[model samples]
Target chain A: MISPSQVEVDRDKGNFHYDTDYSFDAGIGLSEDVIRYISEVKEEDPWVLDFRLKALKTFEKKPMPTHWATEDLKNINFDVIRYYLAKGQKPSRTWDEVPDDVKNTFERLGIPEQERKFLAGVEAQFDSEAAYSRMNEELEKEGVIFVGSTEGLKEHPEIFRKWFGKVIPTSDNKFSALNSAVFSGGSFIYIPPGVKLAQPLQAYFRINAENFGQFERTLIIADEGSEVMYMEGCTAPKFETSTLHSAVVELVALKGAKIQYVTVQNWSNNVFNLVTKRALAEEEAEVRWIDCNIGSRLTMKYPGVILRGRKARGEVVSIALANDGQHQDTGAKMVHAADETSSNVVSKSISIGEGRSSYRGLVQMPGHLKGCKNNTECDALLINNNSQTDTYPAITVQGDANSVQHEASVSKVSAEQIFYMQQRGLGEAEAMSLCVNGFVNDLIREFPMEYSVELKRLIDLEMEGSVG
Target chain B: MNSLKIENLQASIEDKAILHGLSLEIPKGEVHAIMGPNGSGKSTLAKVLSGHPSYKVDGGSATLDEENILGLEPDEISRLGLFLAFQYPMEVPGVTIANFIRAARNARLPEGEKVKAVDFYKELYEHMDDLGMDRKFTARSLNDGFSGGEKKRCEILQMSMLSPKYCILDETDSGLDIDALRVVSEGVNRMRNPDRGILVITHYQRLLEYIVPDYVHVMSEGKIVRTGGKELALELEERGYDWIKQEAVA
Candidate 1:
């Protein structure tokens, strides 16, 4: 554990490569043989193999999405991506038990140190499996289960099987189907009734290999009256070839329970981040997605929620920054299935240089649901003349007497605003950062304190010398 | 000695001429006031001196203690001990007053050295108290939704925190109430020292009554038409700017 005196605000320290002795490799391409190889290495049952094969068939049948940003989506070549690579290691309760190379990689990312200081639990996923995962003694005593997905399915099948694919099925989207077919390391968290953890649990997903695909399937279930916050962070080294990160996350909050799922994705600009995340909120339950996207060549993610019971609430507070050579097409979806359910979506984006950021949202409310309210706000800021942003918010409100309001705005940073801060002793770049920070300050506050500070520093780095 | 000097300063916005061959010299330990009517280039002089990008300096030079500040960025000129309190302060949403001032102060420091947090807050609270600003103003976004008087008081608070060697208050008295004007004047009065110079530009004489200047100059056509002692402000208040324009003609 790193003491408080040794902590500094630093992350993503560039590429760190090593000569890894791979214990298992599925090589490139996806087929029945590759699926069989992954299942054989994991020693999974025949039923699990059947699930992977069925999902693989679905993934092959689903056509590429041509509705939005199809040109960027066409750049991804599934044939070239290596499906799985695991550095032989089971989950270690202690940090020292991990291998030297994996240990060095995580120490640079400050995983164990953060767990010691603030987090209730920490799970570090290297390539295909969890390298280290541990929870606090108090949380363990309170019947909180925090472990890898494979371990969860093997040990706690009764709880895991019930909510596995209930929130999001395999055929939800093309990427989700791809993830279900070859999914590997991801977090599986369970909290019993009335057990409210004081700190958040975080999983840091790191991709170290070239032309690799990281398909992490995360499932979290909050029991009745329980509350928890699960944070997911991503980073990868710079490679000449493209990398793929397609994750499927499903969350279930039982009656009177609350859950918050936050994602701070800082993948290298060479990677494609296509993810499907959704949650099911029961009676009086609340779920939120606080997402911040910074570095990615292309990202298409829209985390949604299905309000399953009366008085359930959902919210998506997100901020996306797209610098040069990046496109972030991300938003939220809210479905009002139960009466008196409420939801809100606030999305803010910044596009600088030749970058592009967009907001694509969907809100659906049926006619029978009364008193269902939803509010959606999307705001975008363009840094330079060449930058671009778009908003496609589709709202369907039926005969029900529900109130659904949507507001959006697209604006460029005015020269006057920049000059105002500049006159107060900030240089042009500093002024630009201040403006961008101001644009998304309210939503960024929704994040945890540590991540909020890091997000500001990341924006400052992106805005460095970005003027035309 | 610390000083700000401008010689034959000609500036313009777009194609129109604003400041035509303006000349002024303000030495250390003195407060100079310039009273002008609207469209007489009073605010333009402040913007040009602060290196506003929209204003083009056609000719002449502005120097802060022997260093030419015309071609430098606004921040560079500001760090060289030149401060311009804008006539209409822009509202920057989500940037708190505390952090903005801290960034400005940190920008003036040498590389790798940080301003001590304890000292910064202590000095900031003291300045806010003198300005009659609420303590909560520190956390609020700078000038966002501020009343006219609140905006001026905030600008004064910033000026006190920055402590530039040369201070320029352009039309600081335009939107102030009587009570706010007195509080703002007290805040400015507390910062007076032997090594720092102040230049106050206003269209009205009410502000001059509170913070009396060492010399009062009347600008008619971008240049100083007349100069005199403190009594000149009272004369201008009674006779109006027509006397000054006619004096230039005569």
Candidate 2:
């Protein structure tokens, strides 16, 4: 009998890190001078420079958090991380105009290809040009502004000046302070009132340097009666030395508007990813965060929403996977500030080998708010005896007229389920992959169709050799 | 040439014997039914044939045609054209029925070959239609939250799609209603051909009424003690298995 031919493996994940010579490098380490050098290099305004120095002070003054924290955070040597590095080139509008180094990434990825492919680089180029041209023209006429944060600050200060750092301030968290001190390259978007974009704006970011830090600050504001979805992807090349990725993303959904932010981050096992993401929703506005995490040595990300206006709603659906010496600590936070607000958070995690995953969450509704509701669901799937998972949720419901429902479940791959699939002709590995895929299927389905397919393939690749 | 031959099969679960010196032969082109009461090892035999990890085959020689499948993995056995319509089909959440069955079908293809999507979906839709399952069910998770009759019908839908050379329906009628039984029986009957053999395991003659057997065997205490034609099932239904046990002693 002929054995099945080897299906083409995901070479991208394996060779994801080959250090290309950088045109410019800041070397290694962080200092006040390093922060000043970065702001000066970016040619920032005095207000922004002052903002950076203040955030740097906060970063230096705040002690590393130990509460529900991983020791990996303490392992981060502030002195050894390069605060910033850029190739000294600007983003080109057309594929032909892009420099050779950056062009290599998106030569075939197409000009109007959703921004995620350019930033994420998780897979090889796959979108057709005809499909891009058909949609790019329609988006241009809708008063939707999608650009880099640098360009947004330089060109459209009217939109960026007020909303930047408003949702997540520099001192909100230690990592947010660090990011505020040296942030670069994240997307900046503005949607005018009553305008809606059909296609999601996408951006991709990856780090190739070891012992380096990538700090990206993304700000998106959807005006009243407007709707937009922004998605970004993050993947870094693997290295022996530790790398740090700290990002701060702030979003504002104005009255009667909706904004959905989706992130699929798969960093190398040696990277420490600490990110602060939060959204402020106005009256009758809505915001949603769909997060998928697959690989990292340690990741502490809790995408949160502040329901600040009446009848506002917030939702977060996330799935995290941890494998062999990896830790993924992620969850959601919803702070209800107005009456008649609603929030929902659904989180799923899978731990294989000695990998450990945790869900740390907070849901709060003050005593004065009348008729607010929140629902939280956390599910964990362990693939082996050595795998571990934990869930810590802090929910405070003060006074009356607030309802909260929380459900948490931890499960192993069912032996009966494995045997059942086997009886139908799937091998042990195939059976395991199917079960793992099934475990996160409901949440993964929430992703855009193109991404859901690649995400499943990536999950299948991780499940290989997962059988013990 | 299709024959499921088991000789002096001795199997156990956790060192405790279940099947003691059981022997059964099912040849091609006929439906053979095995009827027994609870704890008679009917399900054990099915599990052992499928090479379930829990069961230890102490002494057994089982073969599908020329190959000895006594110790092969369940997937290997399935690829070799042996299908078991489980008594309690598993619930696989988030795995669509279309993908599950497609994966199974794809397992049979040679290296690097893929099952054509059009042909696969056409065949799936045709069989699902014949089984009276909604087209939407194909996209739904496999047997997840399905009613008992729905589960039994799904088993038959799989059986019809896979079209194995030798099929052992392990209590396929246990949870099925009369309408479901008739539909499941018809789906099974549609696959009856000269090159295929079917072994139906049941506790009562109710299912046999819809899917008639050419030969009937009464298994008592883990071994087949009596063999007869179609009339034997009716007689056992009327007289009960106790008489058969007493008759065996006499």
> Model 2, range B19-109, lDDT digits (tens) per residue?
9888988888999999987898999999999988889999969999868998898899999989999999989878899999988888888
Cα deviation at B58, candidate 2, in Å, is 3.2
Model 2 C-alpha lDDT per residue in residues A253-355, reported as the tens digit of each score:
9999999888888777888889999999999999999999988789999999999999999999999998887899999999999999999999999988778
Top model number, lDDT: 1
Off by over 4 Å in 1: A1-14, B14-17, B112-119, B230-250
Put down candidate 1 lDDT per residue, A278-361, tens digits, no spaces.
999999999999999988799999999999999999999999988778899999999999999999999999988778998999
**Cα misplacement distance, residue A419 of candidate 1 (Å):** 2.5
**Which residue pairs clash within candidate 1?**
none
DockQ (CA atoms), all models: 0.49, 0.51
**Quality class of the docking in candidate 1, CAPRI style:** medium
Tell me how candidate 1 scores on lDDT. 0.88
Model 1 TM: 0.92
TM-score of each: 0.92, 0.89
